[model samples]
Target: MRVKGEIDAYEVMAVNPYKALIVPRMVSGFLITPILTLIGTFTGILGGYIITVMVQGSNAWGFMGNLFNWLDMTDILGGIIKAAFFGILVILISCYYGFHVRGGAAGVGQATNDAVVASVVSIMVMNYFLTTAFFGFNI
Candidate 1:
């Protein structure tokens, strides 16, 4: 159960008992979030293009023209911001639970379950607050 370039878990704890294991994960999240968002955005637009042009027989030029016309800079920026925050939140929650895991395999399983549930809940709750903060409630 060893991966190349990966230190043994026990060895890591031995060398730095108080070290925060989440730091690298947080850094990775920051790096990965924007790249994922860009890929997802492109894939979504491509899917729309496929549906409109290939399936529905719409002109590609008109499909793209309408798509670009309807999408605004704010929409793209807001999505990126939200993605970044969500990435950070997910990493933080997972690391918090992972770092605190105890009682062997059972504890690891419990920690994983808790991390996933907490992350999803936090993301949903935060998304609402973030959306409201970024674009004030209209009602």
Candidate 2:
């Protein structure tokens, strides 16, 4: 919707419509991805701790020892990197479709659907490549 608004408003005035539509999302994604990744990572760890220690009656000390012993910096860094890339992917794909929306409300709806599907597919494909590049057969 933000991209659509920018495109619609600047369609006649902007010298470069693509830049007008894409820049804002790019900037926002770059700014937001790392913060979100940190929050998500901590939330995931907390959820795991709650489920394993509280719900499953596991020894908290043993769980923490095993988890910390098995998990390395590479694992955490790789997840953060993947999240950042996914954020950029979603922003770019969404802006691409939304900025080009036509027809009316129906087009906007179609564009939104396309954007979500494209983002998910792109994230999965990119995840495979990123995993290969980052971890090879170890993952």
Candidate with best lDDT:
2
lDDT of 1 by residue, 1-139 (tens): 1222223564665754224455777888977897899899999999988988999998999988888899898888888898899999999888878776776678878889999999999999999999987767565
Distance (Å) between predicted and true CA of 132, model 1?
Answer: 1.9
Least accurate 10 contiguous residues by lDDT in model 2? 1-10
Each model's lDDT comes to 0.81, 0.83
Q: lDDT of model 1 at residue 18?
A: 28
Q: In model 2, which runs have C-alpha deviations exceeding 4 angstroms?
A: 1-11, 14-16, 137-139
Per-model TM-score versus the true fold: 0.81, 0.85
> Where does candidate 1 clash, by residue pair?
none
Give each prediction's root-mean-square deviation over alpha carbons.
4.2, 2.6
Model 2 agreement with the true structure over 1-139: per-residue lDDT tens digits: 4434755566667557667657877878967897888898889989999999999999999988998999999888888788788888889998888767787788888999999999989989998999999888754
The weakest ten consecutive residues by lDDT in model 1 span 1-10
* Cα misplacement distance, residue 2 of candidate 2 (Å): 9.9
